[model samples]
Target chain A: MTVDHEPVSTADGGEPRFSTWTGKARGWALRRLPPDKLLPEGQPSYVSSWIYVFGMGAVAALVYIIGSGIVLALNGPTWFHVSSLGRFINSTHLWSVELFFMFMVIHLWGKFWMAAWRGGRVLTWITGMLAFVVSIVTAFTGYLLQTNFDSQWIAFQAKDALNAVGIGAWFNVADLGQILMWHITLLPLAVAVVVALHVVLVRMHGVVPPLEAAASDAQLSSATPNPATESEHRK
Target chain B: MLGIQQTDAGMPDPGIYFQWGDFLIQFGNLVVIATMVVLFILALVIPFPGRRSRK
Candidate 1:
């Protein structure tokens, strides 16, 4: 395989930096969200709450889930059934997924209480919810890939549900090949993209302050330099 | 009713189910849910350590 490491353009012409597509895209991204805000060194003091940890915990669990899942995918379903090492990895993948959901659910609960969608953060909330929905589907497809009696039973039950909802036309839960592809590829990719977007939105908007801190920030917007609003206004 | 059934193979028998009226859930799922609830409560109640400021 040939490696193309050199820059596409070598000539130091007098063209404007933003003339190229990459330059223009960079300019747009930087203008929308500066580097400092995208990766802040410190958050507001109001973020000193244990509830904030669950979001990161969920992300960590997702990392483990994906890593273990990659191993399982490499080994295939039969390896997991026959090999002890494969079985261990499969169990690791399963437990990681369970932990991921647990942590994500707690994060959701915390965000719900914090009114994390406040201050034009509707997209962030929507993306998070979308990730949750997609993760559920991903996990369901994973169950169907287990290739056991439980999987068979779940597939039959889910087929009827999908049929009732008219999704059976395009999506067949009984089809192992189709479900395996969904479990291992499509749904996971969707989850990753949506979760990444959610995180980017959170960083773009900054973490939502506590309700009382937000209310006070509004009341003292004129008198004091509200760091939260200051960042918003700067943006 | 919540105990795991152990078979002669020494493996914990799977498919332990708990039901209340028409509602049904695996005991393991119930444990997960309960643990999540507890963790959520503790997270809300517990104080998070603040970052140390540079002197």
Candidate 2:
């Protein structure tokens, strides 16, 4: 396998890694959100707001959820559903999801209360919300994969709801194998992708400034930064 | 009765509401879960249209 690391130029036809669509995307990301901007030594003083902890908490809980989920997945349903150690790991996975959802809800509420879309951070807010919605779907599919009476009941109930919206035909919540695949593979992959995009946008946009700080910055701008009226914005 | 009402067949019917007075004997996970879900959708849709920020 030959490794071509050089930038692709259409003129040279070498499939440049830095000039193609993938290259352009990487370059755009690096230019728009440098590493220093993605992670900083210190946050804005206004970021000391306690509500911000919810976002970190959500991320931390997801780490635990994914780790425990991996353990359970490796053990397989036969073990996790029946064996003592497997059950323990299963419980841990369940609680991690609960924790994740709790933290995410608090984070959402906090962002909403803060009007986190301020300061031209609309895409950041949108990405965050999309991640949340995807996470919820992931969590739901996990519940259906539980292999228990509760899962059975939930599957029956959820299938009707999905059917009502024309989503059931595509997803078929009552199908055991389908839900297992979704819970273990498809949904998680979707969640991870959405979450990554959300994080990228968060890094690119910078965290939403507190209302007071945002208002002051608007007033301080020499270019008359009326975010309320401006169709475009500057960094 | 609320929560899981038993059918003659041994399956449970998740109730939406309950009736109780002296102490409180019933709760419905389905209704609560469904309501919270609907609430999430409403919460998402209510504010700005997700296109742009506004004061």
DockQ of each: 0.37, 0.07
Over B6-52, each residue of candidate 1 has an lDDT whose tens digit, in order, gives 32322234556665666767778889999999999998887776444
Question: How far out, in Å, is residue A143 in model 2?
Answer: 1.5
Predicted model with the maximum TM-score:
1
Per-model TM-score versus the true fold = 0.81, 0.70
Best-fitting candidate, measured by DockQ? 1
Tell me how candidate 1 scores on lDDT: 0.80
* Candidate 2 lDDT tens digits, A53-105: 66778788888888888888787988987899998989888878876776687
**Residue-level lDDT for A210 in candidate 1:** 73
Whole-model lDDT, model 2: 0.70
lDDT of 1 at B5: 39
State each model's CA lDDT, in order: 0.80, 0.70
Off by over 4 Å in 1: A1-23, A214-235, B1-14, B50-55
Docking class of 2: incorrect
Top candidate by lDDT: 1
Sequence-dependent TM-score of model 2: 0.70
Candidate 1 lDDT over A127-223, as tens digits, reads 9999999999999999898888778878888899999999996999999999988888999899999999999888877788777775656433432
